[model samples]
Target: MDGLFLLSSYAVKDAILIRPFSLADIQSVMEIQSACYPANLLEEAEHLIAKHQQSPLSCWVATEHQKAIAYLLTHPWSGDTPPALNTPLPPKKPKSDIYFIHDLAVLPSARGLGLAKRLFDTAIDWAKQEKLQKIRLIAIAGAADFWIKQGLSPVNDKTLSHKLDDYGSDTHYLEAAI
Candidate 1:
């Protein structure tokens, strides 16, 4: 089968729902993560759910036909020391608010349907609504071009080395003003 022909029918026709994430959607989110990534991806879903439950501004999920297909988690960039792995993220600063997009994934079956862009647009809109000055994220290997096309620019400062050892080598830091 030709690759182009195989890729042309991947578009999702059902309505794409973008909304705040809740505990009820955790399992679906995890399933999408498992389908899209090589490694287990829900280690932080529980934490994200809890944080969102406490503060709805922190996370959002995108669904197609009532099934979670993509999700994004955002956290404030405080000046204090970064929290330990798995700890709840701190709140944003008042003067120069910044949101760090910790995770974003769209199921493989749902790729090329504009789901990722929708998720990104939702996050960027939220940040702007909150008067945030910047949105930052680390583009995993193979995702730099996608992010660049979305107006995210690579930052030369420190990288997310501790999260994934290979992150330093494969990931590029990116940020965009909202």
Candidate 2:
């Protein structure tokens, strides 16, 4: 968090905007993901593109001065199982009561600018707008605390423990009411 611009004077707080992702923004999206996550955990481009292509309205990018600095990917899911990372979503949106957050990555330099909160708010607002019941995600990269602070709680269901295992040993399935 060293390079994070915490003060509003940086204007990153006021100037940041969130919009739908475009194919042209892929590289910047990938760069931000690379900076935020390890190589093995970073989502593949195919999966990212497919998610957006499937539910363009559910995927979004946060920008500063019109440059992509962060992104959030989400899709509908029917059951408790979260989709495997790096796997492409189906071409059509799934029928479901849950909105699964597939990814939320902000560059280290942009961490304190409130981009993550903005992207998170966007997801919550979208779910409400679409009449989805709740939001879900697999917490990784030691992000369980962050999600918990955002109002998501860890799933304690015995049945979900195995499906969540695919994410990693520390992976946590979290959900929040809409």
Predict model 2's lDDT versus the native.
Answer: 0.83
In model 2, the Cα lDDT at residue 145 comes to 86
Whole-model lDDT per candidate: 0.70, 0.83
For residues 60-136, what per-residue lDDT tens digits would candidate 1 score against the true structure? 88877677888876666744223343456555355646677777888888888897888888888877787878777
lDDT for 156 in candidate 2 is 71
What RMSD does each model have against the real structure? 8.1, 6.4
Q: What TM-score would each prediction reach against the true structure?
A: 0.76, 0.86
Cα lDDT tens digits, model 2, 1-178, are: 5446465455664678788888888889899989988777877888788887777888899988888999998887777667777876655545689888888998998888888888999888889999999888999868898899899997778887777665677788999988
Query: Where does the lowest 10-residue lDDT sum fall in candidate 2?
Result: 1-10
Task: Tell me how far the alpha carbon of residue 103 in candidate 1 is from the true structure, in angstroms, after superposition.
Answer: 1.2
